[model samples]
Target: MQPFDAKPLSDGDEQLLAALLDGMEAGLCAFDRDGVITHWNSEAVRILGWSADDAVGRRGFSGWAARTADAHDVQTRLLGAMDAPGRQVHEFALLTKDGHRVLVRTQSAAVQGQDGRPAGVYCAFSEVHAQIDLERSIALSEALFDDASWGVVLIDADLRPAVVNAHAARLLRTGRDTLLGRPLGDLLEQGLEELETALQHVLAEGSPPVPSELWLSLRGDESAKRHCWRSGFVRLGSPLGEEPVPLGVGWLFLDVTEAKLAEQEGSLLRFRHNQLHRAGRTASECEDPVEAATTYLDFALAGFADHALVDLAGDDGRLVRAASTPEGSSGPCLPVPVGTIPVAYGAAHPVLQAVERIGTVRASFGALAAAEPASRARIDEWAAARRWPEGTVHGLSTVLRSRGRTLGAVTFLRGAGRRLFDRSDAAYAEDVAVRVAAALDLAQQLG
Candidate 1:
């Protein structure tokens, strides 16, 4: 058997070990088999206001460091770890040198000797509140990554995803592991600049009081569906640093696309309804019913379409242009020239389809409108064949009906830069068509 003094650690090694123990964030102390204090680190001094010189040579935490009534029980529990298989946890009310009482939670493990016999016990401890705070932080992180309803993401300073929660991963349409360390630009087809700018602002200025909305397009899809997300951000800074040093950003977002769209649709419908009411009131003042019908068409054009054409069913069952917005520039709806020829619309035209079915008909150039030069030429020919104005790329034709009889059909046109008309737009156009149809029917009755 080797003697304890035969191969004792060198002074330098002892100093290094002491330095390592002192640098730890936790308070550490060790006791020998005989219950004599053998080690005391700087954290212990900082916690209990006891110097190493005073703490190292003491027996168990009795008289000075613990209540006289509780010292014996606390010592017994700490020393019990020497015979325990693993670490034993306990809480003790410890007394600082200044006579302040601090409740501490401790984990004590047995240290073994050369013969595998229990030689001593080492206990690491911290203030109870600090220990509970650490546990709370870990639990919160786990909950967010596993079961949160909204998307939660941790983005590092380099603007890359560091940690992504399940909800966020699903929203991004990718696996959590696949998104980590990837730039946001790779995931978004548009609005990357706005997102980055918002992130930078959070890192520099801290969190904003209210959540912000961001609309973005996803990559690798041609449907061009844009999504709205209501997002909040918090700047994370290192707790250990003296000055606030940016660690990353915590981003939380909820999908609000449906809600936002509903709000916009409701607002637009209200505006259109108000316009209709105003147009009706203004039209009643005009003595000429034809002029009143044009006034109705003019009011319908605001924020609805770039151009609109009103056709009347002629005696030959063909459509003749009654009123139209001027081409090449914006203008008021004017009656067509007297004795003008009817529009040369073919059988399969959108206007003809609406007239035949007495319902709304939607048409567009489709992919050809956005295609190369050759396909663009085809678009021009397609519009010309329908007798539509040049540069028209999208169209919606709604049948006009009044007094249970089809009055005519009104066609709305959008240029190449505008979006293709959707069902909602068709609905709004139908509402406008009702007013225009009544006005046109009155004109026919008056004439």
Candidate 2:
């Protein structure tokens, strides 16, 4: 094999190399085998406040770049890398041109010659504090993605999930890779509009002063259960850009569904208690016992349901409608004049079931079919067969009992727009039934 011959670098080549080294972000300096400085880049000059003309011919850092007491050790460590393998890391306290001390971290590597011998060494360095700050930022980012208790998601500028942490992936009920780049609507069954609005607001107007709580439903669940998230958002921008340029948004959230539900339940309970108290006060002033019974029904409808009906047990095991809200729309409960008139409610009706079992009974039309026209006809027929008012989709019947005896049943009806009756609704209806039963028992005794 022929030995390769290398030509010396042209003046243009040297100038180009010098410009490249001068433009580097890290300070760079090269030393010869004889311990003379051969090259000093612009970053090194800027850090030490010395010109390349003065630095390139200096033998070592002693007496100028470093304190005399520390210079010998620093120079020995820097020069030691010339004979060592790979790179060597070291920290040194160096003197700037203005005599201020600056601590720096340096990485030194041996520069090999064509004969496979160490020709010199080159060192790259940056301020120790700056390097430490960079390391801390990287550590924080890693911790957020790996070990955070709350959910963390990095959403791109287009509002798609770019990165999802483990906590966030679990909340989304998906793998991290599956959520990436997918639209927010694809993951959430509802509340996408509100989420996107919040993300866009963060990108355009910066973060809001307070974190927001969002209620959303998940896809592919039969219950269609809703969840509440206490979410915070921050807009990420490009640090390298001259002006603030939006990169994406960072979202952190925690599942607050149970807490929020408890809060709402407490508030609802308080309001219902107040309503019951108010109804008792107003009913006491009524001239007729039946009027007071209707007053209880009117107050119970405030935030519980759209309409209410009170039926009283009549002769031959039949029930008669005693009072009810308006049939066309929501209104105060009025006493029905159907005296001794037994309603044609079948045996299997929810209201009749409640009376027979002495417990609350709940029923709904169940999810409507996709076909609108046919589904509408089916719903109407379903409502009519049960003698419910128009648009009633959900019904709750609580048995009206007074002193261990069943008086009748009171039914609460909700329109198609409202949610189905759950256990909480049953409990509230039972509370109202207690009040209604007392007033009706009094009416029966007085009549």
Candidate 3:
């Protein structure tokens, strides 16, 4: 690079000045100290349909550009900027080439002479509506990044955060500057590929008409929860380029995890309630009380677990497996007489715990689920050691109690594909156990 050579305004410099002024987006005009127009750019011609030949050397818009009534006030404001310390702002109407009136907003500043004195005034103006539109855009941009309640983020073409608002920073649990230029995968423990796909799609196509619901897991948080975000995206493009150039994406989102969870809970509750109702009606049609118990268990297992067991507290305090849902080849509960063969459940077993406490006991395969590259053989061995099905990873055991007497226990088992049994599962299991126990109690009394 070479230093720019400074010289007095020769013909070459004058041509350079003309090119620079014509390239500007704003309409520009310059007036000498005597209020005679000395320069006019192509933008000024485009705005008011007056060419440089028609505008330059004209005296202060008194005849052509402005009506005679408004010319005096307009010229006074334009020339007054030469005496002002800073730019002067004014809005006035001017006449076009065909005598049409155009409202314009102008910014005028004094042009300094080589002798350090005010030599002329240069005015840059645009249509009033266009100026208002630009101002509104700037105001909206500021407000969204500062005062908006939701999270807003600007993503660059690299799919990394370029700018993050305060709410977005808070939601991400980091400082605004800390998130910048960081890959989204750093913040998301899961769904990184899905989110990146969505961003890439936005960069290629335009925004979708509706917002998307994304379930993401936050990394580095011990409690790793599935957080649902209701997100909206917009593809950003550069306005200066002749062709539309993709900048990035504007992402706005709100955490809707709690709401979605509540909705799922409500839907789940309704489903369980319907299952319970249908189970009772079906159990009523059973001829044998034991058959009624199996019917209820069948209804409960539909959406709850993969397998089930019904162990009745037998004579002499032993637990005999009365019935069970098939688990591959295992059926500790039998074709034998219902009370003859007792299941060999260890003392620390979930069923034993539920029976002793007269409450629910939930157990899961500890740490095995979290281990990377967990082996199917190991899972089988673990389940076999506990006398469970080959793939069982979670279990919920609840005591079957009716009329203040404990009859036995009902255990629901889940495989690795399902989430562990939670409190809501226990509550629903208890409800099923209550009905099963009542049917068993009636059978024992009749016997």
The most accurate candidate by TM-score is 2
Model 2 poorest 10 in a row by lDDT: 367-376
Candidate 2: which stretches are off by over 4 Å? 1-19, 113-116, 367-374
Return the clash pairs for model 2, or none. none
lDDT of 2: 0.87
Q: What is the Cα-based lDDT of residue 69 in candidate 1?
A: 88
> Model 1 segments beyond 4 Å from truth?
1-18, 98-100, 112-118, 367-378
lDDT (10s digit) by residue, model 3, range 380-401: 8878877888888888999999
Worst 10 residues of 3 by lDDT: 1-10
Q: For model 1, how does the per-residue alpha-carbon lDDT over 232-298 read when each residue is reduced to its tens digit? A: 9999998887898998899999999999999998998899889889999999999887788788878
RMSD of each: 3.3, 3.6, 3.7
Which pairs of residues have clashing backbones in candidate 3?
A: none
* Per-candidate TM-score against the hidden true structure: 0.89, 0.91, 0.91
TM-score, predicted candidate 3 vs. hidden true structure: 0.91
Clash totals, every prediction? 0, 0, 0
Reference-based lDDT, each prediction: 0.87, 0.87, 0.87
Q: After superposition, how far is residue 175 of candidate 3 from its true place, in Å?
A: 0.8
